[model samples]
Target: MLRQSSRFVVNRASAALVGRGRRFSTDLPAETGGDSKFVDDWKKVIPNLEPPKTPSAYMKPRPQTPSTIPSKLTVNLVLPYDSALSAKEVDMVIVPASTGQMGVLPGHVATIAELKPGVLSVHEGNDVTKYFLSGGFAFVHANSITDIVAIEATPLDQIDIASVQKGLTEFQQKLNSASTDLEKAQAQIGVDVHSALNAALTG
Candidate 1:
């Protein structure tokens, strides 16, 4: 009776172990040859991967826009007093007008304007620089060209501050002793010219 009861217990334990093994096999991944459908259906249920981040479109540098009206005429830039500026572009001229600074580019309307004594800022493409002119009249044509007839054009780099100051002092003395309207006008022009030169130098 005792041997029969021990045999029955052993058979029940063996059946339990087989059932656990079957359960474990069903829980394994498909790659391991288990009956798991999870791997096959995973891609359909999961969300798509996102693209990598990129720089904002607004942050990119833009190319320069082409001018609508192109100039056909060739410019001739002349600075009688400064030899260094003779090599600069002849067109797209900037001249100091009597009233203010005037900018001339190609396709500009034809006009003649008086110039004041001041610094003329010239721009060729993105690069810009300045030249000092005492007095001049700028003539612009419809052909997109300009001619600056200047009394004197001085490069700022070539100006001697001490010499300019001396000229200013002498002109001031002449202003004080002016005996005629013409002399006063000449003195005033000299003072204005020197003042413009000093401003360009200091700037």
Candidate 2:
């Protein structure tokens, strides 16, 4: 008797859904460019309440992928205070990733790499520029666009080798004399950064 009653209830529910001819909430809304379909329905249900705008209304549309890969990669290197490079097209870029130095070229696969304290190189036709970065991230997009954000970046030529050598020696002494874990860690970081700077300059 209970089974028959349950079946009847389910049958009635299904019949009602079929009879109404209205799509369920799970059904996809028709494409209306960027506007939300829910906003239209909400306005009809509650005329007094203001409808909220969707993120699509505020966000800009992404560029469509081209059939052929681009010849040059568009790069943008940004720092905290200023833009280092903006919309510059280059043949290749080499970044010091945590794993190793990664070389990126045009039509490279999308990737996000964690940077380390090392040199970042940008290669054009005949000229190559180098910069030393403290640390940051590199984002490679599918559209042959690369974005680099660094905590600190200085031109390779501007770095002082003498200062780096002095700091390295001082940090080595501090690391040897450090008694606490925090001190050791701090000294180690200083040593690593100085070492990287020295290597970038000499190597």
Question: Top TM-score: which candidate number?
Answer: 2
Candidate 1 wrong stretches, greater than 4 Å: 1-68, 71-74, 78-92, 180-182
Clashing pairs in 2: none
Per-residue accuracy of model 2 over 79-196 as CA lDDT, tens digit each: 9998999999999999999999999998887788999999999999989999999999998876788899998999999989999999999999999999999999999999999999
- Predictions in order: lDDT: 0.59, 0.82
Candidate with top lDDT is 2
lDDT of 1 by residue, 1-203 (tens): 44544454465447647846422211233243231233333333332522222222123222122256663333545556543343345445666776666677766666778888877666776766666776667666554555566766656777899988889889989999999999999998788778777777876
Estimate the TM-score for candidate 2: 0.73
lDDT of 2 at 36: 53
